[model samples]
Target: MTDTSSKPILILGGTGKTGRRLAERLTAKDVPVRIGSRSGSPRFDWEVPATWGLAMQGVGAIYISYYPDIAVPGAAETVGAFARLAVANGVTRLVLLSGRGETEAQRAEEMVKASGADWTILRCAWFSQNFSEGFLVESLLGGEVALPVGNVGEPFIDADDIADAAFVALTEPGHVGQLYELTGPRLLSFADAVAEIAKAAGRDIRYIKVSHDEFAAAMAAHELPPEITWLLNELFTEVLDGRNEALTDGVQRVLGRAPKDFSAYANETAATGIWSN
Candidate 1:
């Protein structure tokens, strides 16, 4: 055994998708888990660095899943500084949730690797959960989805697989200093993904491909928070330019299995009555 029983693991962004799943998985394995959130016991907050140390106390491993994303401005500095502190506080291993094709996220990954702690980076593609748990949820439930993405095929990844990959890296010994580009086994365009979701949900759904300006205007009309709206627009416009259309064998390479299919995710999520008529 690797003797992780000596100290608990701190999971940053424990309320978010990957973090939440990671926490659940770790807890299921009887690994002591400390949720690093403002609502947690020690109350870890990324915007407020003072809280980090308190939450990190007695933690030997950390699952660093930054909210919004590591691609956001100032995330690299925040993560870098926190990694140093976590290592100083006796954290021995770190698993970072990073974004695919994101230069900024790549910078943060490098910082984690240089933190003098055992590190594994799960560089993931756009998540399949976006339609069920994130931005596209409402639109999917509304029967029409509009986006700036057009004909750009993305190997949309499952958060569950991301969590699984993180589990292996966090608990295993041979995964140190590795960057795994985690993605789904197949590629699907935005429209194709929505169509799959619609079929799974047993509802008639439509996808509208619009210009970036139009998408931004629609989001503004919905009173979406300005910063979030700006970020979403930037991601769709700048990041979805066919940069992540290709597939990879990262899931197989890491876990000895292929990544989950989008259809499976759609069907499973639909069974939850998320997009019910």
Candidate 2:
């Protein structure tokens, strides 16, 4: 276990997908963790800057996982401010969960680097958990997964792999000032991924390629939050257009092992019955 100087590592967005898993791993290793969420003590809100000071108190390091996304407009400034605040408060070790190929995400990465902290950026591809643990679960359970993307291949990384990489980055030495681009071992289209899940779950799941407008209409019908609707539409349209198709060795570089394949993730998550009808 890495020494934290008796101060907890604060995880921003600690209740979120990757943050939650990272918290579990840290706690299991006897590392003290302070969850930075709306429901957490002292209540860390991204929109409310006052709560940030209390959360950073006596923390040796911090895992920065921005809520909603780092791809949204003005996210760079917000994250930059938080990073500066963390550094000013004597918390220098900053690990940011970033996105690949998004201009805003890139900008936010630059901001973190400019903060004069020991920063490591995990520039990641699409998460495999988006299917089972995210908005697509309802559609999969309904027997069909519809999206606006075509045959563009994506190296969908597993959230567990991300957590493991982050664990190494946060707890170990020599990761300072590293920017890791993480991806799964296989290049899988959304349809191909759904098929893998279907095979694993022993169910007849269909993948439908809908138009962009059709996707927006579907999200609207579900009455999702405006930010979520816009984020999904933007992701399925702009971000999924073959920009992040290739695989990277970030996982292997960080963990000294190949990333978990999509098939393996499908099989394991299916066993959890998340995709079962």
Each model's lDDT? 0.87, 0.92
Mind sharing the TM-score for model 2? 0.98
Q: For candidate 1, lDDT tens digit of each residue in 1-277?
A: 1236767778888888888998899889998888888888889888888888889888778889887678887788889999999889777588888998777898998888888978888899999998888988989888999898889999999999999998888777788878899999889998999999999999999999998888878988999876688678768877899888899989998999989999999999999999996
Per residue, candidate 2 scores C-alpha lDDT tens digits across 1-277 of 2347588889988898999999999999889999999988868999899999998898889999998899988899999999999889888899999999898999999999999989999999999999977888999999999999999999999999999999999899989999999999999999999999999999999999999889888888999999998888778878998989898999999999999999999999999998876
Clashing pairs in 2: none
User: Among all windows of ten consecutive residues in candidate 2, which has the lowest summed lDDT?
Assistant: 1-10
lDDT of 1: 0.87
Say which candidate scores most in TM-score. Answer: 2
- Candidate 1 lowest-lDDT run of ten: 1-10
